[model samples]
Target: FTTEDGAVNAGGSLVLFDTATAQQLYLKPGVFQNATVSAEAGVSDRKLLDEITPLLPKDATAQTGKALADRQAKDIESGLTSLNTMLLAFAGIALFVGVFLIANTFTMLIAQRTRELALMRAIGATRRQVKRSVLLEAGVVGTLASVIGFLLGLGLATGLRSAMGLMGGKIPAGPLIVSPTAVGSAFAVGILITVLAAWLPARRAAKIAPVAAMSSVHATASVKSLVVRNSIGGVITLLGSAGIVGGAASGGTSGRQLIAAGAFFALIGVIILIPLLSRPVIALVRPALKKVFGVSGKLASQNAVRNPRRTGATASALAIGLTLVTGISVLGVTLGQAIDKMTTDNIKADYMVSMASGDSLDESALRALSKADGVTALSPQQAAWFEVDGEYHSASAVTPGDVEQVFSLTVESGSLASLKDGQVAVGSKTAKENGWKTGDTLPVKFDDEKKGELKVGAVYKENEFLSPFVIPKELADEHSASTRPEIREIWIKADGGASKANEQAVVDALGDNPAMSVMDRQDIRDMFGGFINTALNIMYGLLAMALLIAVLGVVNTLAMSVFERQQEIGMLRAIGLDRGRVKRMVRLEAVVISVFGAVIGVGLGVFLGWAIGRTLSADIPGYALVIPWDRLGVFLLLAALVGVLASLWPARSAAKLNMLTAIKTE
Candidate 1:
């Protein structure tokens, strides 16, 4: 019923195509968008819906034909809503931070051209003309940048899809769809952000008095303004601190979210306070600079503090990136340590035999493993998840002998051996939560519609791997209707040490079971630990992209600073400062600002990391805050390198500036 090329073939002999093409090809009725039948006329569509509702899935719904069409449209949109939201959120964050860079650039540019603008205004240019001129210039730049960025993003999207495929993602091959709405939105957002950023600078330039055309004097920030700014920043910092403390005591997902929100608020407060702090920090470094590089260091320090707002704004961008990197590093290291400790302490068995992902073990394999040479004891474990009082919980069925021989069960009240048919052992935390005590009879319901009541025979200490509620193997088999239950793991106690524990014999006995593996305690830990490290490394890689953007901001700030100081640099060269000294001064300024930002970021990150770790430690067993000093040292070194590299172009440009031209610049 469809043209051959127009069809979407999904295997077999069948294909799906447009209805118009189908009708033309077949010349027969096939399927409409929807169809309905009735026994008689005058039956409302509502009646048809009711009659057909019973045949649908429980959660599925039916509607009138018009409503059905609307719902179909909504369903199509609903599929992409989550993906769109994620993209927008990420883009929003980058743009929000990039605003600081954009505003800073415009501020510097406008301030340097103040005299030129005043002259233009004196000659004949109206304030509106001057503002429009600036805005128009910004618009042209924004449009070109947006178009180029959008094209680059398309390539990035294709690269990301291919990268995901290489990483074993299950993405289907399809033609890349570039909708007009998406392109329009990207350009609109970019231009809007650029124009808004330039608005304030444009207004300031237009407001310059014509009399100021002959003046080159710069104004210093007022004390009252500094006081008001610092006061507001302090209040924000205090509020954020309070939120973080509150989050530490709070529990669950909401608490974690509060901690994240608090960190963000605190960072913003610190950035706002940077101008107030910059002068004092630079002053403090003056003595060291004077001692080391002599006059050049003194000059660099003076330039760095000339406009505290400019220096602070430039540093704050780098600070934000470093804070996140440091925070993630601290958290990852702490988590890895906690897991290692937990696994080492809880697992007492000499060896463990288990299947890898997407694999299972049969009864014969279990029996063969149990009968292997040098195996003194074996515990077979199987999972039978069940519901109790409308709450789902993992319910493990373990052989009775394993509790005493293979595991170190710290029974709080009753004996572990008391667990038998139709009896269960609950962890202390679970018992406290559910109000269950030893000797309490609990109603249990399995997925297979089997129901039973089990007596709580014991209450043991918390275990992350083992189920909170444990049942006997025989009871699980009798209640569950399945022909065979897959064995999750078999804990083995060797008569000899783990190395000489006849692992080869156990493997050989399993014969054709290629999926199962025999691993000792350390091997088991490494298998899981490897997954954790891999995930953490991937997160670090993604976070580095933010740092890359921060580096760009640094470069932009330094380049503008070079342009603003051209006359001063020319005079210094005329007096006697060599090109090498000129370059060194620029590079040194970059390093000083970079180090200052990194120090502040690292300090804040450590505090946040420690607090977060403490909060998480309450819920997670064996979790403790651990700081890797070596990693932090490497981080500091990397920051220094980034600073030097970021300043390379600016330093070279400042050194190579035509002294004659710069000295004559207005």
Candidate 2:
């Protein structure tokens, strides 16, 4: 036990640690005097020696060392947790995106060989057998991707580990690991997702009647489909969205993730329901557009509207991709805004000073540093998280005179003067998240046996992370002078025009300070900007892969359409329609499809992105989102380009349809 003015006070202590658990106990003499003594018996290997020694008390010294180690380890752990979540989400998105690409490839292959499958059925093969063959083909694709994806995952994880370290995040002591569980999850989920995505298209092949084998072309004119007001798929979709929104509204981490996952499924379900749900609308567009654009335009519009199945199938692929991309982008922005706003309001410091050693600077150095040229003010701040009333609350040291000059904090209730001794100013967001209000008294235990009551000052809406804070520096010094606070960063305020202050110059002049890293305002913005940009790209890239699947779906659908319409094109050539006209028609058909998909994608993507950004901002600091207009324009242009590009080969084939030969094929 250390004495403050000869009054005995046991320092905050860690009482339990094992392979599975670790605990730190902060006690007060009246309520928790024997906490260390009580918990010491729990650890078999590292039992605490209760006896205090003269000169250097064994328990007190060990406890201090343990506390430092624990805090560092926890910081490192928090960093790792973020890294893992980012990667896992990316991996899931990549897998989900790949499903469309692979599914399209299989679908086209099946469509092309429709007559073949029908022939097999005619020759005694069962529908179940045809389904098996199609499923087997999908299985092969899944297996190949899994192997490649796994290899990439390992390499990616390695690079990711190094990148995190370079970006001021902690790196584990060993090489980046791939848990068997993660690998197994990827494999199982990947295969299952692949097979399920292909099932519908595969079923289409299996159900083809034997008459289809004898026909050289799909009898689109003769084939009939059952008309319905609403598809079963569409009903499931609306219900799914309701379930997801309801679950998310219930709150908590699991609920949020479920909401996201539910939305993903919702989009997929919507895609499946598009044919039935959009049929009436498409039929309406056909005649109305026909009169507006005349014969050729009318025909193109009619064809699009006529085959709800094909058009929806093709359009839905792109829609799904666009929705995901847009949603993620929007969410990134909202998250950024929420976090930034919170940080801005909470951090009210004029400048924050760090005192550490070796490169260690402490109270003496801060006193010297605080009086440096171009330094108008400084707050020597010490901060830590402690459990109070079964919840984690931040504890800080603050003084009376230095409060205003340092933290510019606006009290919602109690005055900054009220922070005279044991008062604390809580953040507005913190208060809301933790259900705290003004006039509520909270008791905090620190230094093992020193318990204190901090009267709540008025809540403010600034991120304590961005500015000087609610507490005073002297109180911070006195509290942490004996038990050092973990001081990894410092907040600084410039004396001259902040616009003119040369932060790098000042930092260089100060020399190397081991205890802290100096960062200017621009530095913080740039650092966060860099991370946000990287994060945006990562999210975009994953969704882009998903969109690629849609592109493939486009290529697949158009190829099938081309073959199915070959005779018609040949007949058109025989009539007055030239190669150019036929090709134009095909290309127009593609444009029509792409426009529909792109519009939907833009709408869905924006909504999802905004919602996600809002959620993220509330959770993490420095994540404020601003919508990127330039990117939005780029997204539209890219969709158009990909649409035209997908039609390259098909356009050539459709243009070159041999009149007599094509006519003879049927």
Candidate 3:
């Protein structure tokens, strides 16, 4: 009979029948892959687990319903956690960048309203009243924005679910639930962040003097304030740098956490210090601008440094995005290089054969491959877990005679020839960790209680290509609990190396099993490289959102700058500066700011990458720091391009201004 599809059987057909009838029709007596046991209503799953625990075999495990469900969902949960973390990180970056944009907007708005604020003060408005008014306006804007954002987020989630389903991912069939907590959090965060961003501008507005109602000068931060900010920033930066160095030297999980904390503080410190940094950085680029665009370029450079704080805030957003992207690129490149070095240094086989689905190869498939044309020596590897002194350790079983043909093993203290029955080869790292040495005896037991003792025949140097413990195939076959040993991979040395003909012969021998894959050394390297590239691409995609916000910040800053510099631009136009030159000036200023941010970002990213790589070196064999110079150069070039793109509208607006009207304005 047809059965309703549940979460476990979503996207697939299901049928139900009486267990006795099914056994009579399709099953042999006492034969089944698995059986499900359930308790009556009101019985707890813990009681079921307790009852089954005593009846289970030594190797079997009894889990409660919740435990079993969690175990089964562990991988999916881990994947979702990773995905959510990445999304949240990028989202936070975007929000952080938006903070700068929001702050700048409020600052400019208050600056323009200086006279109005001064008038309010002259009419007996208290500083608190003026501050509260600005904050109230911010709160209203925040509420509206929050409502819009929440609706958009709901739409986006729905779209993502649909897309996942279309891509063949299983999705539970139900309406998406919107929790009260989520709604509350959305409004709370939006309003709080907006009000906080506006606070500084509101304070500045309140500081406007009553006498300033008769003046035309715009409100700006005092020298004392700038000095205080720079001092605080410098102190924070120094602390962050120390933490990074300590984390790198320490090297572990705790060290990584320290590094993360250091990175956050370092980023914030750098952002705070950028206003002080902008002047010198722009000055350094001034000469190049002069050489390229002459007077217009010089004008752009001067204008960029005119408001260092504004320039710094706009550029800081871009810097944050690029820093993350560049750091990830460095790590990805380093990992790819490490894998390439490991494979090249250790693997000697002409070709490697394994299941594409990562399942075990059957004896028949192994036998067929051994008899394939152009095959000279073949080493089949089997993986099994053995309990050694009550600790389960994974061991790889290999043909002792044929291993040397497939792998370039460096014996540190013993000989490979001694790795026979009742003998094992231990990797140096594993040996060091467990205090194992050559000739040390290990009492081991298979899951089926097949007991054996193995002597450490050899202690070899660490090799990333091989398992920590190596055992003879004969010994594994004798002690393994399974009816047959599970062959994980077969390393093949063809008669004429890795040629297409030899690869085809091997494939032909296996009858072209869809589950299996035959790969050369380069193919294996490429497989790992593909994984790294995919991860990098995903990161780049996420970081693009932050970069987009940064671009908008640049656009917003340039637009405001153009508005502020109207009279100056009018004077330049009266002196014969054309629309094209004005546009070029605006674009060049954007480029200078963009390049300045990119330089800091790239430098910080490389340093952070190096620090992270140092932490990984102890665990990863042959790990080395690799800098992808070409990629960094490309990122810098893209930053310049982003500037050019960001300036399009602002430049156009500046060019179209009425010169006479602008010059006549107060």
Highest TM-score scorer: 3
Task: List model 2 lDDT by residue over 1-666, tens digit each.
Answer: 233321122222223434222212122223322233233545532344333224343544434446656887798679789878876776666566556656656666776687888889988999999999888877887788788878887887788777877876653355466788988987888778878878977887787787965585342423234333235566667766765665545545665676677676667767766666455655555665557655555656666655666777677777777777776666655655554465444544433334332133444455555555676555544565444666555555544555456444655655666567556677777777768887777776543335666667657655445232355554444444233444434444566635335454345445655445565544544455466667878777656666777777777777777786777778878887777766666665676676677766777677555444544444565565567677677777777677678877787798887888877755
TM-scores of the candidates in the order shown? 0.83, 0.71, 0.91
RMSD, candidate 2, Å: 9.4
Question: For residues 1-666, what per-residue lDDT tens digits would candidate 1 score against the true structure?
Answer: 564331223222345667767654433355334445453587788787788889776766667777867887699679889877755755665676677777788888888777778889989999999999988888887899899989999999999988876776645457999999989988998898888878877887787777864475443356886789899989888888777777777856777778888887888889888877888877898889879988878888888778888888877877876776677778888988888877777777777788855344567776887778887777777877778988888877887867557666678988777775557889999999889999998887875677777788889997666888777877776766455675788888777757743766667767735677788888978876777688667656656666776677778888998987889899999999999999989887887777777777787788788768767887778888888798888877888788899999999999999898989865
lDDT of prediction 3: 0.86
Comparing candidate 2 with candidate 3, which one achieves the higher TM-score?
3
Q: For each candidate, how many residue pairs have backbone atoms clashing (under 3 Å)?
A: 0, 46, 0
lDDT of candidates 1 onward, in order: 0.78, 0.62, 0.86
> What shift in Å separates residue 116 of candidate 2 from its native position after superposition?
4.2
| Candidate 3, position 241, lDDT | 82
Residue lDDT tens for model 3, 1-666: 555546454665444667765554445445454657899899888888788889877867767767767876796678799777878778888888889988988988887778888888998999999999999999998999999999999999999888888888777688899999989988998888899999998998888787864486576678999999999999888888888889999999888888888888888899999999999888988998899898899999999989888999998988999999899999999988887788888888988889887877877877897789998888887887788889888888888878878888999998888875558899988899999999899888875688878899999986666788888887777776666568888999899799889989989998988778999989988886789898999899888888998999899999999988899999999999999999999999999899888988998898899888889988777898999999999999999999999999999999999999889866
- What is the TM-score of candidate 1? 0.83
